[model samples]
Target: MVLLIGSSMFAQSVSAADPSLAELKKVLQSQIELMKPELKGKVKDLSMDTKMSLMAILAMHSRYSERATLRQVMTEVLSDYQSVLAGIMTDNPEHTADSARRLANHRIPVGGLLPYLGMENISDERLAVLDSFNSSVEGNALKLADAAEAGDMVKAASLIGDISSGCVGCHGVFRSQPGVSDLLSLK
Candidate 1:
């Protein structure tokens, strides 16, 4: 198939470029699938050379083991968020706020292929829009903790909503399964 030919050809060049072609493929495929949505059909648009270039960038940027760790980190973070949400519902604002502060204090490893890249694209342009979302999540967590400590239920509830907006923004793109963005293109 065309994919095999492309991959095979790239493999030779990549192998010559470096002896880690197999590892490169593994890392590239996993990461690309992870960010397939954000890439926005960029793969299909790329020349073999460009795709190879992207693959090289990916291979050099983050290791496969590192990605696994990143995934685990996200899993833990989301689990923590669930605990925080539950605490809020049960009138346990102090606990919820404490949980929220965990996220606020953390740098929040991003999801998808660009986990280590920190919201960068192939062009290496910082996705500036995501910065605001990050700030919102961090900022609201602090405010939520403050509101909860003050026993201001109304303000705490409002801050939770604000925090959720940030989560929604990130999860919509990053948490979805591979091929989701190109579902219509799949036969």
Candidate 2:
């Protein structure tokens, strides 16, 4: 009887400690969702140049060689991106501002594409476009972030719409890449 009781207790503890895959996915999805309002607004109003720059950054970050699988690349990218965003949201104003500026520059390297695609090069045209987009949108995104941080959800919502429009404009101009499409597809 004691053995059975101990086994049951062990099973309960294990179950509590190990979240199900669905639960894990939901947590991740929620985190992504939390940033959506800001992202959508900024994307909508982003200049073509800024959009192109962001696309290039994402492309560069998503690149992978034979060593890493697509899933691995995506996981790492998302994790890193989330960390960056969290830092922006929680850090001191000066640090957040500096980090925001750095991201705005789009100079940070995020390694290669997904492993399945092997080694691939980023196109000059794409990079140029992204540079333009980043320059145009970064300021607005920062502004929205500031408002959101201040608890002004109304301003944040308006800005989020603007961002979404910028994104739509870019998608209209350029063929939507699979990754871009998937990112935007989130409700």
Q: Please tell me which predicted candidate would have the highest lDDT against the true structure.
A: 1
lDDT, candidates in the order shown: 0.51, 0.36
What TM-score would candidate 1 get against the native?
Answer: 0.49
Question: Global CA lDDT of candidate 2, please?
Answer: 0.36
lDDT of 1 by residue, 1-187 (tens): 0011124456456554555776655554444444435453544444565454445434433323322334455565577677667767887878878877765654222223343332233332333334456667767877877887788766777877788888787666445342222311222
Q: Cα RMSDs of all predictions?
A: 10.9, 19.1
Candidate 1 local lDDT, residue 115: 32
Model 2, range 53-103, lDDT digits (tens) per residue?
Answer: 443344322122323333443444344334445554564444433443333
Stretches of candidate 2 off by over 4 Å are 1-126, 135-138, 176-187
